[model samples]
Every structure is written in structure tokens, then in C-alpha cells.
Target: MTDLDAALSDINASAEEDVYVPFEAPEQSELDQKINQYFEGVVVRKDLVKAVRGNAVVPGYVLEYLLGQYAASDDEATIQEGIDTVRSILAEHYVHRNMHMAVKSLIREKGRFRVIDRVTVSLNEKDDVYEASFENLQITKVVIDPDTVKANEKLLVGGVWCICDIEYVHNDSPGSVPWQLGSLKAIQIAGVDFDSYYQGRRSFSTDEWIDLLVQSIGLNPEQFTSRGKLIALTRLVPFVERNYNLVELGPKGTGKSHTFSEFSPNGALISGGEVTVAKLFVNNASGKIGLVGYWDCVAFDEFAANRKTDQNLVNIMKNYMANKVFNRGNIQLGAEASMAFIGNTSHTVPHMLKNSDLFDELPDSYRDSAWLDRIHHYIPGWEVSPIRSEMFSDGYGFVVDYLAEVLRSKRSEDFSDKYKAYFTLDSTVSTRDQDGIRKTFSGLMKLIHPNGEATEDEVRDLLEYSIEGRKRVKDQILRIDATMRDSPVRFRYSDQAGTWHEVTTVEERQYPQLYPRSWNAEAADASGSDLETYAPPIVNPDAASSRSVRSVAPPLPIVPQGGGAAVIPDDDEPLFEGIRDFKAGQKGVSYENLLLPYLVGATKIQIIDPYVRAWHQGRNLGDLIGLLALAKDPADEIEVTLVTGETDKPHQKHDQLLMLKSLKDAADAVGVVLRISLDNAKHDRSIATDQGWRILLGKGLDIWEKPSNPIADARQEFRQIKSDTTFTYARIPVS
Candidate 1:
């Protein structure tokens, strides 16, 4: 029997002996319980990997594969026993590079031993035989048969982590190899039943499934917003979506390469310069296939500006990424490998948007419009949080190997047209743009609604998100190539109700001044259509001008009104009085930006928020007071009154008062008079200024989540908005 067959048989034998019973945790979350109930044997506690992976440099799939075997149960005794077993196995059999001599000595003494090491095989032309090399053992020329190599072809490319059985034999004859490969099984899920996976998905709501999937990928779902969760999942699209080209550029340490490098065995992540046409597509001299033929996804890391790139490789890649085919000599070959490029951006999004296009950081050769257009989606990696200690999940999640297998099996299914039932893309969208949208929509549906069960709103959300991603790519392309401006692409969609929603990237809304004015003019000319727009008031970057005008668009919920230039108002004029919406996960928002412009002339301001009882709430109140101090003339003292709810507990109220007293002292130091009142009867939150404008706050001053690091959040824009908020301005009589 084959090694893989033997491994599957062993697993099946174990399954027969101990049929899986749904694990019941004593105090589990609803999502965790659902994950365990639907996929008991395939789920493992994510924290356990760190506990057992003391100094090991192995990927998560390798460690989780072992953990899933022994630690899948929720019972403490079983989990403990499993952890012990896994620890013992790794301690004894797992090969460490520094201790290879000891393992070799053990194998020689015992005549045969099993070791967990990465094994790579290559054809030795002179010997006319297939030879295997052990990664950690520092050994080569071990003979492996053709049948074994055929069964596991991945051993030829980047190598596969495996449980290997090796034997040492004394050799007296010349040219006789002493090392023997008895058996080898690649560390991966042997099989996945798609039917069971689909049925299991049916048991989960979309939100629950998204959380479960995020947890499986080793992230804390609670730390991410719904939009953030979708962006994170987009990284996995290349794995499940065939020939999908995705690029993510942002600051480092955002886990951009984590999914490709560690989440799945079916993916290969190499440095940008390490790739070549021969290594990626085909070797003309040897007639050997390359990485694309073996892996489902080929990802390039550190794919930023100023890297040396070969023109031939770029030309070949352009064709392969566009058509999924490349010419090797006289033969045309096709590969299903998706392409992912992840790099760090040297500048912030606004800087890039202002100085050059978003693709400005790419190497000169790759920044070509033809090459950039093939990208299916462009992820705004800046929106993703940097990896923090608390971001890693400790709860139960699918064993990554099982999840990988599920993603791989789904490539054959198509949900590309699912969005068409509810919405239609704008005619201005090109065929290529439509293709990118459909593929992204298909991949997201396969992930969130694999059973093809979704409400119209859910489908619309996915469709719009897909359009925004592709639109981000197109919008940047227009900036990079002036020639493309002749045929402008408008990213909009129409629902069955005949209402059009214009989709804009969150960054676009946040920095309207940085966006290209030419495209905004074209969009304005087309504004005759029924559209819903959520355009934030444009702020002039010139600090000398305190007056800014809001972009006028037809008011709607989801669709964007066409863009227009901001009409700069006089410095003495009041700021535009309108409602401004901020989405959750949006950054660059502060009390100074949201309200200070309107509070310019007010000497007295009354803030009414009933929920300011917590420590963070008090901090928010202090921040607003500081903004008020900035708004008032230095010669004039401003009076700020805060009306907030008080806790019933005596100790809590005492602590709150102490915090408020400290804030008052700080306010007094800045020439601001602070008055505090306990008001449990107030239900609404607003800021009333003596300057004739009343600003209604949907979420009050507590708009941001508690920052991971308060000092950093203040110095840098690291905190994301926790709640979707709106600031509605009403003209009240001057107090």
C-alpha cells in the first residue's frame, strides 16, 4: 500500500475505534459551540499550538495536523493526554537541525527509525534514479521509487513536511547508497468530504461562520469589525479561487504573508526576487514543470518598489496572470495557481494618493498598466491591524489542515453569478472589471455561503465589497496611465428597486481632496441617476483655512452620489451644516476633525452623553475638552459642561468622580472651565454650542474602541472607530 493510503487507513482505523461525539464545553461561546458541534474531530484549540510549539519554527498546518490527531477533544483529561502525546512525539521524533547527528546515530543504532522532517526529491540524471533529501537531517542521495514520487509530486518543488521512516545500512560496495526511505507521508489532511462541509455550513449564520473562519485562521474575531473580517478573509481567496491575482501593500507586520506561508500546505510563499520563469512555470532545458503546476497558490513576499526584476519573467507573468497559460518552447501550458503579491508600503495611503497612485510602490516593471489590470482584487492592507499579542485567538477553531482541504475542494464550484439575482453592474464597468468582481463575489460566497443560501441583502453586501476591491485597482490604474482616462470606469450597481449605490473606497471618502478631480467631474456629470451617497465633508489640508465645503450628492443609504469639487467658503463663514456618516473600522477620525470645525466660534459648549461612566468614556470626554480648548481664543476662557450618567455602585461612582476631578484640573490648566453633572434621565447624545449649531452625535464622544496602546493611538492613527457614527448639524438659535 502507498504511504498516503497507509496514513488514511490508520486514520480510518482510529475513527472506527473511537467514533466522534460532539464536544461540549462547560462555558463556551455560541459560535465556538456551533463550530465544535458541526466539526468536532476537525477542530482544535488555537492556543494549544503556541503552548506546544516552544521553539519550533514549523508552520501552523504542520503543528495543527499533529494536534488535531491528539487534542481534538474538549475534555480536559483527553486534551492533556493528547498534548502530552504530541509533545512526546515531537521531542523524540521531530528532527532539529542542531541535533541531526543524534537522530542519525539513533537510526544507525536502531537500524530503522521514524522522524518528522521536510523531505525533497529530485531526479539524479547521472544515476538515472530518483533521490530524496532530508531538510533537517542534512542528508542526501537516499533512493526513492518512481511510484512514491508520483504519489507525492509536491516533494519536487518547495518540498513537503512529512513523517518519514528512514533506515541506515552499512555499505562495503563502491557507489552503493547507505540511506533508505521506508515510508513517507506528507503532513496534510488526507481527504475532505465536501458534502459534510457544505451541510455543516448550513448550520451557521453568515456572521457565525465568518467568526468561525476567522478564528480558524488564528485571529480574534472580536478585535475585527464586519468589514475588517471580510478584508482578512479576502487574503484566502487566492487559495480557493483559481487563477485569482491579489495584491496587498501596506506597513509591515500586518500578517499580509501569514495566510500564504503558514495557513495552507497547498500554497508556496517565496521572496519576490526568488521567482523565475523556469522555477515558476517550466524549465525549458530539463522539460520539468514548476511550482505553478504543483501548488494552488504562489505568493511573492516583499513585492515592493526598488526590487530588481527580470523583464522576461514579467512578460511571462503578465500572460499567465491574464490568461492562466504560458508558452514553454513550442507547447502551451495551463496552470490553476493563483498569484498573490504582498509588500510593505513606505508611505501612508494619503501620501501615496497625493504624491502618486497607490501602485507607486511597485517595481517599475510591474507598475505597467497591462500588468496591474490583471489583478483581481487590491486589498487595503492599511485597514488591517498590525499583529498584536491579543489578536491571536485561544478558542476552538478548525484544524488548519482540514480547513485548507475544504478550501481546495471548493475551487471546482462556482458562485460567480449569485450576485446577478439581486443587482446589476454599471455599463461603464469593463468586461475585465466584471470578471474581477464575479470572481471575488464567487470566492466570498464560497467562503460565507457555500450552500448557496443567502438573503438579498447579504448577496448585495458581498457584491458591493467585491466591486470596491476591484474599483480600487481600476481607480489607481487611471492615475498611473493617463491614456486609460478616455474610457473611465464607474463602480456602481443597481438593486431590483431601481436604486443605484455608488461604491467608494473608505480611503476615498476619508481624503476627498487627494482623489483625482477629473474622475470626480466625470462622476458628477453622470449624477442624474438615482443614487445614494455618503460623502464626508471635505477638509482643506491647508491649516490656514478653517472653512471647508461638503460635497453635494443625492442623499441615499448605500449608493454614493457623484463626486464634486469642494467650494471653499470664507474663513468667517460657518462650516456646512449637514449629517456626516463614518463607517466602523474607518480611521483618521478625531473630535478635532468631526466637530471642532463647527465649534469654532462657541465660547460655551454643553456635551450631553448618558453613557460616559467607564474609564475610556472619561478619557473621551477629556479629549473633547482638549479640542474645545484648541477652538477657543487663547485670551478667552471657554466654559465646557459635561452631562453624563452615574453608576449605582458607590465605589464605581467614587472612582468616576475622582477621574472627573483629575480631568477638570487638566482642563483648568488649559484656560477651560469644566462643569460636570450626573444625569441618568438623558437618552440622547449631542453637543450644543453658543455658535448657533447643535451637533447630534449618534455614538457620542466614545466613537473609538479602547486602543491597544493608548500612547500609540494618540501619536499615530492606530485606533479604529468601534461604532458607526453620524454627526448631524442643526441651526439652533445662538445661546
Candidate 2:
């Protein structure tokens, strides 16, 4: 075992309860391991059988019944024997309907046998009888006396779970019609008492609870990295929060719906298109309550596409989401149901941010401000990539049913006050606007920092991210409805005199460079009268010639063709040469090597780039910091300033500040003295580090492709570099 595994094992072993086990490979494949893990320790035999089947599209309880008859064991031999026995039972007595003769023969020969099937029932009170029906047997109108019905009411009826027995009663003569009398055994099958189980395990720490949950899902936590575990845990937040609406829009095959549908009885997951007003709210005709009234959380699967939703339904849903109540033919009912809307996105994050805001392709009705306002949090689904086989955990976690209750009960506690003393919102922000934002911010804080002792920087980060989520909703609504006024959402420092600033969505302030023409207003303004007065585009003949030439040309002679020998330019001035044909480690041409000369004694550097406002932009600065760390400095402090646009809002400013903080922290750790500043100047791509060191840049910060997979390698990759791929730097200086 690795050091991490050994450490985890030691921790688990020391726990009050057995929380983890050393990684052990099952005799079967990984798929089999999952099945065994789900069923091995469960008390119910039927559940074991169903888990082994692994989602074959059968009624869950029916599979459970089969599992109960077989495979309820930790022993491999017994499980194999049970599997064979269960298969034999299915082949012998279970009717497939297509094989009519086989079913008839089994009924006749077996005389009396138990078969798992769907059954329908109708009460015939007038006749003092109850009629039982079976689909597979093609049997209907079988009657049971009152006493027998009471005893066997739980038998299968149509799609419901029930237990019944058929008795053939001969009437008066041989060859006469035979009457079948079936007895109802029971009405509803009881699920495991999850509430009691949850209460029993409530005292476990969050990490312990997560481990138990992972084990309940039949995954080995060891297979997943810490970050992977956190991502998976984030999926559980919806279950833990009451009336908490969560939307996860990421790439497909991420197991987004697995926890809701398979892990708990309190949750329900329906297809995105299947949702209707009546199904979600109340049935007007019969007063039959819908999913929202029954399930704690109803997740809408595949809820992303713009074209696949009903406009009218979306309107009613908007109100339902906001008030937690819906109107159905004048009858109103309140519900505490939390909604989860999960979907798949076709475009990358940067691409989507450039084209439109995060909620760009949502249906018209769902795009309403009233509805979007109710959504507490917006998970950056794209940040969560598709699930791989390696991401599952081998560690133990709580059964989801238990965790759901913990979150529901903890709803009464508030954590927003944790930041009240340290920071505040800009005065222009309203209370109504802060409700949703603060609630979500507080909920996350409670989950992560329950004691309310989070540091100032941590509080600031969560607050900014939380505000950005709400801002995404509000901004999109403004685009849809011109009448909607902009909400003043900003964060401020309570102790500082002038720290308050307006918050803006990352898409609105930082994505212009990647998609310059997509912003409707900005594009319109630039395309109008401003174009004529704007400066003309500059071109370099040397750059143009380099693109056209296929082979390298020899250097020209010092002597001119019609004059005295030309004087070679002095190399004293640092010449910023943009590495057109640059590759890493070509003698002294790497990024690290190039920056060493400037660090020694160079002064007065200028960097011009338009896309350096985002998190990725901060990474470029980080890289420069690393290069500077290599320079020899004991008594000297290098002063570096940046030239870039001011971010459109305070949140962007916050992001920039955080980026600088990281740099500062790293520099301090290594004892490096560096000072950096930002400047707003319009110019072509170039940088002048120190006097006379000039570099002409191509593509500026908008070069390089985003890495396809971040977890694969460390170096020469975007993830390893700790910055966005939206930047490339070159050196240049004035002659």
C-alpha cells in the first residue's frame, strides 16, 4: 500500500467505529465488485439479487425478491450457487409472456408455486369480493373472499407489490368450469427503516459520513483522488439540503443522476421532457399529489437543451420554484421539495462564456427572472468532467438516505453571520437581492465551515463565487426582458474606507477577448460610428515575410552593395526578440532562460495583453513569478508593472486580487522580492522587460489550446502550469 493508503487505514482503524478497510480485490471483475459491495452486508436477501442484476430495466422489488432467494452471502461459493439457483427459478417458473405454453405447463405441473410478477386488483364491494389480475399469466377476474383478501392483501396486483395464492375449486362435476380463488397477502412492501438508521449514525464526522456513503454506493474510495472525492461529495449537497435546488450541467456520463435515483428512496429522477404541470404539482381532477409532494428532491434529468421544453409548463414552474407553492385550478398546496435540474452541455466553458452567459441555451419560459431568482446555487457543471472508471472510491461512506436527513435537519442553522464582521456588501445592494445569494453562500459555508471560523480570504472567495452564481441568473434575465432593472450585487470590506465595488459575472467581464463579436451591445457599438475613428491596423513586413518563406535565409553581409561597410548595431541594449521558431530548451531560448537576463539589471518593462483578467490570466503572472524566483537577488527588489484593462466589476477585481495574493504568498515563501502593478493601455502584442529588451508578440495571451484531460500529466500542460491557456508572452524593448 502507498503512504496515503496506509495513513488512511491507520486513521480508520483508530476511529470509534470501523470506517474503512484495506483495499482488497474481489475474485471477480470490478463490475462484480460493485455488485458484491452493494449487497454483501444488507439484511434483505432480495436487495442482494437486485444489485447483482445491475440495472436491467426490471421492477426494483421484483429483482430484490429474486436476490432474496439467491446470492445473499459474503462467501464467493455461496453467491455462485445462489446465482445458479436464481437462474433456474427464473427459467422454470418466471413467465416471459412470449412463451405461453411453457407458462401454462409450469402452472399445471407445479400445482402451487410462488412467482414474482406484476398484478392489478379491483375491489368489488357489492359482490363482497376482490378481483385479482396478472399480466404474465393472462389471468383476470380471480376472486377472493373477505377473510382471504385481508390475509393476502399485500400480494402483487398490476404494477403494485402484492402476495397471493391461487386455489382451484371444482364446482359440482368433472369437466365443469374451475373457479380460481386467490387470497391477498399484503398491500405495500416495507422499505428498510432509513430514518432510524440515519439517526443511529448521525454523530459521524462529515468525512466519515462521506466514506460510508461511498461504500453504500459500492465504490472503493481508494480508487478516487481527494479532488475526485470532493466532486462526488458535492453531488450529495442536494440531498443534504432541504428545499435546496441544484443544477449540474456538465459533460455526459458523469453519474449525475445515480445518487438521486439509486442511492435513496426519498429522491426521484425523471427525464427532462417528461415533466408536466400536473405531474410535478397536483392533478386537478383527482386531487392526486405529484412528485413534488412525495419526494424530498425531484431531479429533472437531461434538462439543458433549449428546444426541448414546454413554454407554458416552464411558466408555472417558475412560480412554483419561487414560492414553494403551485396553483392547480384554484387549489394551492405548499411543498418543501427541492428541485434538481441536471443536463449535458455541448460546448466548452470558455466557448459558452464567449457566446453567451452560462444559462444561454435555456428555454424562454425558464429564462424568466422570477424563476432564476429562486435557484440558490449554480454549480459550474463544465468544471466536472465525465466520470472515469478510476474515479470511484474504495473507502466507506454513509448510506445516502442517512446523509439526506442530516442535511434536511441542519437547514435551520445559519452561517452567513460568519462573514458579517469581517466583510459587507456594497451599500447599494438590496436585502431582497441578497437573500438568495447569502442563503446559498451561507449553506456552503455551513457545510464546509460549520464553526464560523473561516479566514477572511476563504470567506471572500465563497462570497464572490456565490454572488457570481446569482449574477449569472440576473444578467441572463436582463437580456431576455428589457424592463428588468439590474440588481446592485457587490462585496465590500467593512473596515476599509473605499473597498465596496459592483460584482459582475465572469462571462460578462472577462470573456470579451475570446468572443469579441458575440456581445450584442459591444458589437453594435464597435460596428457603428466608432469604427471609422478607431486607429488603423498595424502590420510588420518582417512578420509577413516570415509566414511566406519556407526555408531559412542566410544573414546579409555587413558591407552594403553601394556604400561603405555598414555598422553592426550594439548588443548592449536588450533586444526583445519574440521567439517565432521557439521551442523549450533550445540553448538559452526557453521561457525560464529568456527571463534570467532581465532579472539581473533590466528596468522599465511593458506587457500588452487584453485577456489577462480571468483566473487563467493569473496563471501567466504565476509563471513569470516562478522565472523571477530563479534570479539571484539578496539586496535587490525587482519592480514589475502590468498593462491591462480594468475588470468590469468588483468580483473580477476580487479574482485578480486573489491571484496576486497567491503570487505574493509563493514569493514570500521563497524569500523573493517582487512588486507588480496593472496599467490600462491600448497597444499591439509586445513586452519590454528592462531598458532596451523588446519582444514582439504573436497571438498575445490568446494562444495555446486547452488541455483535453487535466489529470493526465504535470508538465507542459495547462493543469500543471496553474494558469489559463489564454495567454502567451514575448519580450520587446524600445531602441
Candidate 3:
């Protein structure tokens, strides 16, 4: 065994080896080892969130603490049994918002029985005694030992949220309070053995470690392509590194704040309010630290700006975000918390590019160049799919408390310099730009290679990723604040051979308009704008490119705003017969552009795709109905027959029927009769119409993936298809 493996194995061996994991899945087995072999003793399976979680709403860190105590065993029965016990404890001892009176009665009847509640401690100067208050239980002025107050002073500030055991003493004794603190502990604490964490880290390869983290979040890495996996992993950055400023702006349902709110105890996902100086930084009137001082990460959800919020608050946050320190009166306080901004975009990528910058929706005050420069990374939340039920893994991972502690501990180390050996950053990069790159580099390194053992390729991938993230931040900044057009923030690096390498962000290459509006001005683009735009590049090489694309028709078709009838020209609405690219922020073309023309003038269309088994696939068919309504004559009836596969699994037939039936009913309401059939031998996916038009599709009826919401899905063009699949549209003249 490798030394790292032996070290991890030795630790596991030394502990009681009788622990068994439940559910016996391949993913579960991998999760079991990730905890024992790599993050041994320091990680917890997050799906345990569902098992132990009851009606009593509690933070994840608290349950993780309970899990680490009773359920941190490898034995399946032990884990299962532990979950039951934890559930029981929560039901009985944990305080519920509605059952506070009942819990109080239990404490009174039991003569100081222990119950779980949030305990905040403060000194009562008049009595010269320390007092504690239990949140939700509505109990206050409970006496606490001075040492207890001293040991957990976080309570004195914003009130450390915790699960505390309070004893209720009904005493007629004079000068004595009925409440007493039996036991007190913060809801979250991070105490990690960095040496052992590093030692265990040496055992796994880069891919293995990345997979472990992806699994830790209760997701299967195999489900996501490599780039998709990386996109998903970017959410973990704020957890591992301190004072890391990040933002993920995209459509809703992408689960942007899911990690901070649900996974770890140290992070908080607050509603993305316009910055408030008192809430985030400090409240000078109360002489208390704000969220920044207490939490490891503070994610702002629903974060799009209205351009009307208080500018002073925005300025204060900008300073804190950049410097990791905020001024409170005369005293300046430093905090270790990272900041994250998550929100949905109001406009389509193309609409924004043409009408406004990508950052246009942000509050005008927040769109300041000074603030954008502080962010280390910008995860394209657009790239992530809505969290479907299938995205979660049924596996074993460390109790979150263990992982939280490990991440908390690594905040002190600097992995930003680790990549310097293999590559040298260009001197032209600005200080803020360098800071952004280094912070991103440092966080990814700590996540994938905590032991600092990375091959040249691994290091370069991370480095390039780091630079790209920062570039996303900088590129948008220029578009938002034209004054920054002169900034020298080029991301260039050189290898040991002095072979200089320049990094171009994914958006930069695809959306070259940000540099010079004239770059693709004459090339035929997807937006179908008047300018001559060239077909953009495709991520999938097999997918054809429209490099030589030219507009066959001078005028673009204008369908009614809300799926109303379209005014077709005399010549078959000018069939779009050229290559079209939809990657990057490219606008205009969508499933509507691809499917509508061929779908026009056809009364019957048969969709042959085998994988229409899930709700999303069924929903894709539903959307096609909407498209059909737009192209319908309204006087002529339309027919759509679905030829999909039937799996042999139990309930498969029932589920497929139920889903298709719902779709069929909806299709009937729109002047269309929908047909469904079972086709076992169906391999190829295509759309055949009565007009002798047969269109070949790379992804079958699965051409359009799930968008952020139902509304976006209804508006076909608003949704972005991350998959690089091709579609061929051809019409045979009544053969």
C-alpha cells in the first residue's frame, strides 16, 4: 500500500472496524472509501440530510454533529440504527417552533430535563450575572456560568445559532431564575488535523479526489461530463477557502445556494438583498459583529440588482469583499467569511449583449468596476442544469461536520503559489487580477490536491481554470464600465521552457464582440441580426459549423410575442438552410429556429426518440406543442405521434403511460391529436412529417435540455442548450 493509503488504512484499522454502510450501491461503496481512505474521519455523507431530518427544521451542521457522534460508523446497520436514534432525539428533545409550549411543559414536568434550543449568552450588568436566551423555545434570562459565557462569546455578538440543552427549574427560591444552562456548544466548529488530512490526501489521484468531493455533495460525477463536473465542483470553492468572493448568476432552480445552506454548518445563504452595511459587516449601534465575523461563507441568494439600492451600503460591501475587512466605527474588524452572489438573469444572453452588458441587471452601484474586481470566480450558473431528482446520489459520504472542519482548517494555508513552479504569470496582469487568479488557484488546489502533489497537466488545467474564472469577472467589468477599457489585465503565462501561453476565456473566444464590435460584424450570427455574421465554433467537432454561413433571406421572421400565429412569407418562410451556432452567449437561434421551419406547412409530424421516459423528456414534447401552436393555421388540425422505447423495469409502463397521457390531454386542447406507441426496435431519432420532410436529430426529441424554470422552457429561445448536438433539416418534394 502507498504510505498515504497505509496511513489512512492504519487510522481506519485502529478504530473499531465493525461499522457497516447501508444501501450497497457502487456510489455508496465509493463514498464509504472516500470517507475512510481519503477524508477518513473528516467527511460525512450529505444524503444523511434526508434520513435524520424530521419535521423539526434544523441546520445541517447540527444534524451532522449528531451524526458524527452516533452514526459515524462504517457498519450499515450501525448507520441505519444511528439515523433512527437521531430522529428520535430530534423528535423528543429538539425544540419546534410550534411546540415550544409543549417542550417547556416537558422541561417543567421532568424537573429540569434537557431539551435542544438555540442559546445566546449576554452579561446582565444589573444582576452582575450572565444570562442565556433560548431561541424558538421563547425562554430568556436563564442563568449561565461566567465561564460558559466566556467559552462561547460568539453568542454575545449576532448570537451564535446552536443546539443547546437547557434545563428548566421551577423554583420558588428567591433571587433564582427557573432556567439553567445544562450544556452549550456552537452549532458549527472546525477543528481539523491538517497533517493527517494532507497525509490522507496523498493516496488519491486528481480524478479520484474530484469524484470524492462531487460525491460528498451527494452527486454522481459519472453523471456529469468532465467539464460539467468541474462546473459543479466550482460551487465548493467558498467552503474550502476563507474570504473567497464568488458569484454564480444564472436562471433559478440551478441550486446556486444549495451548497452553502444545506451542506455545511459554517456557511449561510442569505436572501440576496442589496448590501446592508449593518447586516453584513457590523452594527455600530449594537457594538456587534455581523455575518462576516461568524460564518465561513455568506451567500447572497436572489442577488440581481435593481440599480436603486443604497450606494453607501454597496461601497462598504465592496471594501469588505476586496479586503476581507470592514470598518466598524473607529475600529476595523477582519472576518474570515467568503461572500457569494447568486441570482437569475432577467434577459437572454443575446438580448443583454445587444441591448446591455451581461452585468446590466446588477444594481448600478454594484456594477462598479471596483467591486467586480474583488470577485475571484464567476461560476456560469447558466451551465448547470436545474437540480433534477436524479442528480442526487444514494451513497455514503462523511458526516458534514468532519468535512466542514477540514475545509475550515485549510483556509490558513496558501496553495496559490503551488502552480508557480511549472508556469510564470505575465507581469502585465494587474494586482487585483493576480489576486483573483491566485485565490481561485489556491482554492481548487486545496480541494483536488490538498497534499500539493499535482502533475504538470493537472496544474495547468487548474491554472487555466483559475485564469478563466478571473477573466469572466474582468471581461464583464469592461463591458459594464467602459472606463476600464484601458485596463491591462491580460491572463498570460509561460512554462519552464519559456513557451508563452495566453489564456482566452470561453466567453472571450465565443463572444468576440466584447473586444471589437467589428470582429464578427459582417459574419452571419445566430441572433439573425442585420450584421453579416459568421457561424460560431462548436465544442463537438462532429457537430457541423456555419463558418461560411450567409443569410439566404434578407428578412428575419417575426413570430408573435406569446406563441401567437406567425406571418409567413410566400416562399415557405425562407427555410433556414445554413449552419447555426448556439454556444457561448450567442443569441437568436434556438429549438424554435431549428424545428419551426421544417415543422411549418406539415399537418402530421412523428417524433421518434427512445428516451422519453422521464418527466423532463415528456416536458420537451409538451414544449413542442407550444411551438406547433405558434406555427398552426388554427383552422387545420395537427397530429403528433410519439414513438419512444419501453423499458422492462417495473412500473415503467405505468409511468410512461401516465406521463404520456398527461401530455396527450394537453396536446388535444391545442387543436392537435397526440399519439403514443412502444417501439423496441427504434434506434435512430428523427422527425417525419406528412410533407415528405424528415429531419435528423443528434439527441432525438431530447434536443432541448431543461431550462431554469417552466416559464423559460415555454419561451424556447431563452433556454441554452449546453450539449453540442447537430440537427439536419431537409424536405423531399412529395416523393
Task: Estimate, for each residue in 286-348, the C-alpha lDDT of model 1 and write its tens digit.
Answer: 988899999999999998943798899999999999999988799999999999999987555
Q: Per-residue CA lDDT of candidate 3, range 218-293, in tens?
A: 7867677777788777787887888899988875566777787767766767776645677788778877677888
Q: Give lDDT tens digits, candidate 2, residues 541-634.
A: 1221122111122221133335676443232333233333332222212234333333334434456665566776667656665555434222
Angstrom error of the Cα, residue 706, model 3: value is: 23
The 0-to-1 C-alpha lDDT of every candidate, in the order given, reads 0.80, 0.51, 0.69
Candidates in descending lDDT order:
1, 3, 2
Best by lDDT: 1
Q: Residue 593: error of model 2 in Å?
A: 20
Candidate 2: what lDDT? 0.51
Q: What is the lDDT of candidate 1?
A: 0.80
Off by more than 4 A, model 3: 1-31, 34-43, 122-130, 157-161, 171-177, 188-191, 305-308, 511-595, 598-735
> Given candidate 3, what's the lDDT at residue 518?
28
Order of the predicted models by TM-score, top scorer first: 1, 3, 2
TM-score against truth, every candidate: 0.71, 0.51, 0.70
Residue 167 lDDT (model 3) = 70
